[model samples]
Each structure stands twice: as C-alpha cells, then as structure tokens.
Target chain A: MEFYPKLKASIEEIFATMIFLDLTAAEPLAAGTEDLGCHVSAMIGLSGDFNALLGIHCPAKVGLAIGSAMLGMELEEIDDDTKDALGEISNMLAGGIKESFAGENVNLLLALPTTISGKSYKINTPSGSQRVIFPCEIEAGRFYIDFKYSPR
Target chain B: MGKTVLIVDDSNTMRKIVSRALRQAGIDFSEILEASDGQEALDVLAKNKVDIVLSDINMPNMTGLEFLKAKAENAAIKDIPVVMISTETGADIIDQAKALGAKGAVKKPFTPDLINETLGPLL
Candidate 1:
C-alpha cells in the first residue's frame, strides 16, 4: 500500500513524459480476485529481495491509443504495435519499482517482458502472495496495474 | 556527414521511443537500424556502418553488456561508441559498462533532454 503512491507517481511521470498521456488513478480496485477482464496484458517477473510479478492490464482500445501516442504512428486495432506498447509500459513500471527500491536490503532483477492479448482471461497469483490493483483512467480509457509479491 | 544509429532492444516499443527521442533531439541520421538482441545487433553491424549503438542492458539471447564487450573486442566495430539505456540503476553496473568501452550509460525512464545531453557530444 505504501508503494502504491510511488507506483502511481511513476506511472504518471512515464505516461506524461514518454507516452504523451496523462493518467488519473481511481479508487484502488478490489484485489485478490481472478475474475478480471484483460484484453491486453503484459507481465514481467521480479526476483531477488523478494519474488513477485507485475503486470499492466488494459483493454484493446487503450493499448492502441497508447501505442499510437507513443510512436506517433496511427494504430486502429490490437496488433503487434499495441502489444509492444503494453509490454513496454509494464517494463517501465517494473524498472521504476526496482530503481526506487534498489537501496533496500534485497537485490532485484526484472525478467524480460511478455505480452498476452485476448477477449478476457484470468491472472492467477500465488495464493500466499500479496496482491494490489491500481485502477487508473486515461484520456482514451481505463487500465490497471497489478502488483503481486511474496518474500522468497 | 549524416550518421547511422542502431537501437538494440527486445521490446519493439522501447526501440520506437529511443528512435523518436533521437530524432527529437535533432540528431541527423542517414539511417536508423534496429535489432532485437545483441547477436542480431552484430549482424546489423556486419551489414551496415553504424555510427552509434543505443542498447538495453537486459535482453534475451544477448544482453547489452555482452554486446558492448563483443563490440569492444571486434576489430571492425571496436570504435563505434555505445551508449547504454537501461532500467539498471546500479553504479557498479554503469561503471562496469564504462569499463567495457561504453561511451556512456543512461538509466531507464529517460527524458528526451537526458538522451540529448548524453549523446550530443558523442554525436
């Protein structure tokens, strides 16, 4: 929970400076539920001080919007461009988190980012992991950043 | 003389952002090449005369540090200045990159101005 504010600030800075979009966070979403609709999802694993997973989940439209804005290339649908944008956003988030917590007791490394896109799917976290969801709204649409972590 | 720059990153999106930043920084380039990893970057270098290499530290197949070391050891590509742009923020890693013959290192979530300042003199 303490990290969510830092996470929100990081997302805002990245979107405003890198992607040319401004994001507004909504009330934190209910966490620990597998019933989520993710049209586009990009995930990167965290290792070191603690083991965890971080992901960006958004609808197809939001993904396309972000891709188009960041690349200055027109994109109308969910394609490689959109998927790549989603993955990079998640990558940036994971990297930001790692950098912010670098001085902590544990060392962390981020895994390569992977993207998945579909109508709807469930992301199951380890039962013991602590899960938090930060729901945010952008000019184009709404998206969510999911953080799941557990001490290794 | 116009230059040629190669961007090496596994994520296509990060590559786009880097390329865009370079363009926005007013760096004139005759060509901008891209590769998914270090080995692919070597292949690109084999075929093209790249003036600068912008790379990510963590990638599949071959990492940026590995690529920089390879470039340093190669007779043909040894002089090409490499600037590392990565999420890695450790001073030790940056120092290691410098030791491996990197011209400079920029941490991730970089702004356009940061990119400009880092690469301007080298370019």
Candidate 2:
C-alpha cells in the first residue's frame, strides 16, 4: 500500500478527533526537506515489516492550547510538561497511522517524541534524505509534522 | 478502600496526569510511587508495595520492553498488573506488554473515566 495517502487520511482523522480540526496542506512535503512552521515534534520508528519515521508538528500556539487543555491550566511557558505533552500527542498520531497499515505485514517501534521548540527548524533523517515539511494552521499558531519513510 | 498505585513513565507531564486522574476519579490510593523507566521500575518494585502499574512504552536508558524482561525473571514484579499508555501503534509492543504480564492497555489522550473504567475494580 502507498504510505502517503493512508498517512494523509490518518492525519485528518487524528486531528479531527483529538484537536478538533481538519488539516489541509497545499502539497505533501518532499521526502526530506527542512521547511516547517512552529510546532511540536513527535517521532516514532518503524521496523520489522516497516521501517521509517513518523512525526506530528503542531503550531506553537496550537500546541500550547492543546497542552493547556490537558493540564487544566493556562500554559504561559513552554516548559517540560508542555513539551512532553506534545511529544506524546505526536506519538499518538503515529500510532493512529500504524493501525491503518495493519495486515501489510509491516511492523513498528515507536520512540518517545523528542520535543523541539521554536518558530521553525529543519528535520533531516537517515532514512529519507528529504524532510517532508508539514505546515499546520490553528487558532493559536501554526506548526507541521516532518515525515520520512524507509522500508526494511 | 484506598488502593496502592505504581505510576510509570519518563514524562513528568504524563505521570502527573495519571496521578491526577487517579485522584480525580476518586480512586483513593494508599500510596503512589514513581519510576523513570522499566529499570528504575524494577528497582522500585524491590522496595515498595504497589497494586497497579501504569506504564509508558518508550523511554531513554531503558525502554518499556527492558522492564518487562526484568519482570519476567523477578517473581514478585511479574505478578503486578501493568497498563501501557502510549501513542505507539505497533501491535507487537502491545502483545509484548501482555506477554510480560500487563493486565490491560490504554492509549494516549485517555480520559480519567477511561482510566477508572480500565483499572476500576482491581485498582
């Protein structure tokens, strides 16, 4: 099965269900290009049947709002808790995608999401030379997930 | 009756959320303990008395699998119920968690009600 369309569907489902948004993009970022908006990064490793990296990058303000909603407190600073929450969120989104790939004989190994803060950054991976830039817009701010895939 | 809880996860955010959820659920617990990863969790088992363990699968230093391996050998830790919470979609990992003696599993973005429902009577 092709990964991109399934991935896109998965992203739409995850965001709609969890964050209450419908994510749309001008186009899927090329395999590996370091061009993304402000967001949280959650990456998981795929191995066994499938080997690749999946991540979710949410705009900073959106991330904060999500964190704030979870914490039951206003998030003024992007501290340890906020970063961890976003990482976990990214992890969940990847997990959501994995379910769609079942029966493909592919497997997965998810890692703890490494939280990155800032208005922008570049993601380079060993698997895919080009980073797929994800630009997300929300009420608070904009962010995107940088996705890369490598088959074993 | 207050039960004993063993909270497991590397993230302070998640751990605290689990703890707060437990409290929010009105599931009074006699004691609560923290373990950073599976290794520390095993070490923790050596000293503390806990009823249910809520764990996260991935971590630095020691992933959740490492803890399960240790649990298989340790006669005592093996019996304690483990619940995994992660955004990890891999079925193998979930199977591993069960094979390692986890009682049940709950995904991330879990509500307090879900926690109560999953661990309610036993916890």
Candidate 3:
C-alpha cells in the first residue's frame, strides 16, 4: 500500500492544481464496479524496471466536469475533448508515479495513453500483476484510479 | 508578422492546453501548427516555416526524442528551437532532451507563466 498513498496524493494534487477540483477517496465503495454503467477510461502501459498498467476511470458526468475544467469550457458529452482530458490526466499520473521512483534505480517507460468511453465494459488485470483500485469522490461526481503492477 | 509555433503531442487535449498557455503567455503567434507525433511534426516542418516547436517526449509512432534527433541531424530544421513539454520530470529525460539539442524542457501541468519563463529566452 506504499504506492497507494502516493497514488492518492498524486491524484489529489493533479485534480486540485491542474483541474481546480478536490478529490476525496470514497470508503468501501471506492473501486466498486457496480456503477460503471456509463464511463470514460484512459490507460497507459508502463515498462522498464517494472511492468505496470495505470489508468483512470470516470463517469460521464465527471468526465465532462474534468474536460470542462481542463479546457475552460463546458463539455456536454464524452467526446474527443473528454477523452483528451482523461488522457492528459493519465499521462500526469504516469509522470507522478515515475517521479516517486526517482531513487529506486528503476527506469520506467510510459506508452501513449489509450482512451475509451462507453457503458457495460470491464477491465481485466494482466496475469501476475497486482491490481489496486481506488474510488474517489470529486465535487462533480466520482472517479477511480487502477494501478496494476508486477516485476518484469 | 508574429512568430509561428508548432505544437506536437499525441493527446489533443495537451496540444490545446499548450496552445492556450502560449497565447496566454502573450506570444502573438501568426500561425500555430499541430502534430499528433514527431513524424507528423516533420511533415509539417517540411513545408512550413515554424519559429519553434513544443513537443512531448512519449508518443505513438515517432517520439519527441526521436524527432529531436532527426531535427538535429538535418540542417534544414536543426536550428529551429525545440522545447519539450511532458509529464516526464526525470532528470535523465530532460538532460537527454537537452543533449539532443532541445532549447528547454517544460514539465506537464505547466502554468502559463512557467511556459513563458522557460521558453522566453529561446524565442
């Protein structure tokens, strides 16, 4: 859980400073998959000292809010604008995690982020990777971060 | 005529943000060109007279570093100032960018002032 705390902090910092939103990690319901009915997702593949997958999942409403905040405009749907916002945030998360590993002597390579928006889809963790999901509450709606990692 | 800028990033959102920051920095760009990756940037560079390039390090197809190397090797676009903008805060990455002939490196989630301060000298 060492990375979890840092992950939480990173998420909060990014949301607060970059998007001007505040995030509070939801308890119990955090990481729950029940309400992923309509959502937006962005993921980046990490390689090098360790292989991992890091991603962000947000509901449509939350995605809109994030997109609007990022672009200084109002977004009504999960369109290209919304996907781009999530992708940038995902990239930031990758960088934040990389910064945390500065003294670890491990070099991490982050692939370009992949984004999708829809309903009734599920994400699976790769074999031998530990998946940790954190559900978070934002002013507009809820979102989550999924970090899956395993030594290569 | 104002300066022309080339913004390169795989994420459309990032390109927009950087463009907005540049505008906010009080840089009056005559034309702002965009590219999804380094290869696309090269395509744009071949025909356009861009004053500077702001690129991201990690991208699909051709990366920013690869593009920078290409720019350095070619005399035509070698002198165009390149400023790297990315989530990569690592020293090695920034150092490598500088070594590859980047004029400056701007960390992601950057502020308009930071962008201006870092890229101002190069311009």
Candidate 4:
C-alpha cells in the first residue's frame, strides 16, 4: 500500500489541526546518531497483524507550541503536563488511524508515553531496526516522525 | 439567520475556546448547548432542536466519529450538521468523517478567526 502518502497525510493533519501550524516533510534521513536534542517522542506499538511502531518526535519548542495551542499555556520550560500533552497527541493520532482500520488485522498496545532528553535513543522494532524518519519543521522548531514494523 | 449549535467536548479549556469562537463567528442563537461526550450529547439532542453540532473527535466514553455514526443511523439525528473538532489531521479520518455524513470539520487549538471562518459559511 502507498504507505508514505498515507503517513504524510496523517502527520500533516496532526500538525495542522493540533497547533494550527503547517508541516512540510523533509528528506528521510539515513540512520544517524545526532543528539535529537530536547524533544518529545510519542510511541505507539502496533501489534496483531501489523507488528510495527509509529513514533512522533518533536523538540521542546514544538512540544511547547502544541501545549500553547491546547491549554493556552505559554511554556518556556518543559513540564510534566507538557510531556503528557505530547503523548496524548500521539495516542490520539494513533487512535484515529486505528479507528480507520477497525476490525482489520492490526491491534494497538496501550503504551504510556515517556519523556526523554537527547537524540541518542533508538526505536527497537521488528522492522529493519532503525529510524526511518521524516523531518518536520514547525514554528521555528524542527522535528521528525519515524515508522518501523516488525514480524511476529 | 439563527440556529442552535451544540458544542460537545470533555475539556473546559477547549469548550471555552470553542464557545468564544462561535460567538465571535456571529453565531448568535436563542440557545447554545454543551455536552461532554456522546451519551451526554444524546441527552441534549433528545429534546432540543439543534441545527449544528461541533464536537471534539476524541473523548472518553464516546468519540465524535462514533457519535456521528450513531447519529447517522438515526433518522431524526442524521440531518443535524455535525462538525468534528480535534487535533487529529489524518486524511483517512477526514474522509471517513465525510463519508459518515459530517457537514464539516475543524481542527483543534483553534483560533477565533479560523474557527469562525471554517464554521460560519458551513453552518
């Protein structure tokens, strides 16, 4: 299935609606070890017929921008609620897609979102075992959404 | 020139923003009702003659999509325009909503002007 187009549309929708921002996709980076810096990563595990991971990565600035959009809060510094909002957004996006594929082969694992610093971490999935990432820039902050799937 | 609009969502923060924006859009009505979820919305829709519905797509017991679907199945409820509000931007989701017979859709973290612009003509 034309997955890239689907992913592109989904990511763009999330950004456009969530924070009232426009998102254009950047090049897919070859796996690199750059410190991803201060960002929020939302991970949703796809189980059942589709064994994979859908992850959203955003810098502190993007996270704060989202928070600003929802809570009307101006966040200069990241806080627990800020991180929670990012995680909720990923869950919502994932849930939206899951609803689309309802009764299909895929199942969702209700994973809690974790906040972390640095860009050194990696997603260990059944698929090729690297970040197949797409760069996204919003409100002066740059981020990425990475996807990978694994076999049972 | 006037019609009732029901705004449904769980968050007070979001509800306030939506109400303010609706008012800003010049959507003055004799009645404006608010519901927190599908079941709550059902209650409001039971007797009230609402012309338009603005709902958050994601909520605890019932979601906007589900509400839309259920409303579609009911003859009395189907005609009322349901506009989904959320942070979700999936194309498939939008298509699904349109297919389910949504009159319109708006994304979250809304600006008064944007909300008014998207909803005004549609309503």
Best by DockQ: 1
User: Could you tell which candidate, 1 or 3, scores higher by TM-score?
Assistant: 1
Complex DockQ per candidate: 0.73, 0.37, 0.63, 0.15
lDDT of 2 by residue, A1-152 (tens): 46666666666665554444545644655454465555455566656565667666765677788677656678877777788777766666677666666656555655556776666755544444534545655566666665666556
Give RMSD (Å) of candidate 4 vs. truth. Answer: 6.3
lDDT of each: 0.84, 0.69, 0.84, 0.68
**Better model by DockQ, 1 or 2?**
1
Write candidate 4's Cα lDDT for B1-123 as tens digits: 677889998665466557767776676666778998987898799889998888877677887788888888889888888888875445667888889887777765455677777777766
Off by over 4 Å in 4: A1-5, A13-24, A32-34, A45-49, A69-73, A76-127, B1-4, B10-34, B43-51, B56-58, B65-123
TM-score of 1: 0.92
Docking class of 1: medium
Model 3 alpha-carbon drift over 4 Å, by segment: A26-38, A121-129
Could you give candidate 3's per-residue lDDT for residues B44-123 as a string of tens digits?
Answer: 99999999999999888999999999999989999999999999868988899999999888887778898889888877
Clashes of each: 0, 9, 0, 5
CA RMSD for every model? 2.3, 4.3, 3.0, 6.3
- For B81-118, candidate 2 gives per-residue lDDT tens digits of 88887665357778888887777787765667878898
For candidate 1, write residues A16-119 as lDDT tens digits.
88888878986556535665666989899999888888888888788888889987899998888888888888888888888778756457888988988878
Angstrom error at residue B7, model 3 = 0.6
Docking class of 2: acceptable
Question: Higher-TM-score candidate among 3 and 4?
Answer: 3
Tell me the native contact fraction for each prediction: 0.76, 0.54, 0.76, 0.16
The weakest ten consecutive residues by lDDT in model 3 chain A span: A27-36
- The parts of candidate 2 lying over 4 Å away from their true place are A1-42, A48-50, A118-135, B24-26, B89-91
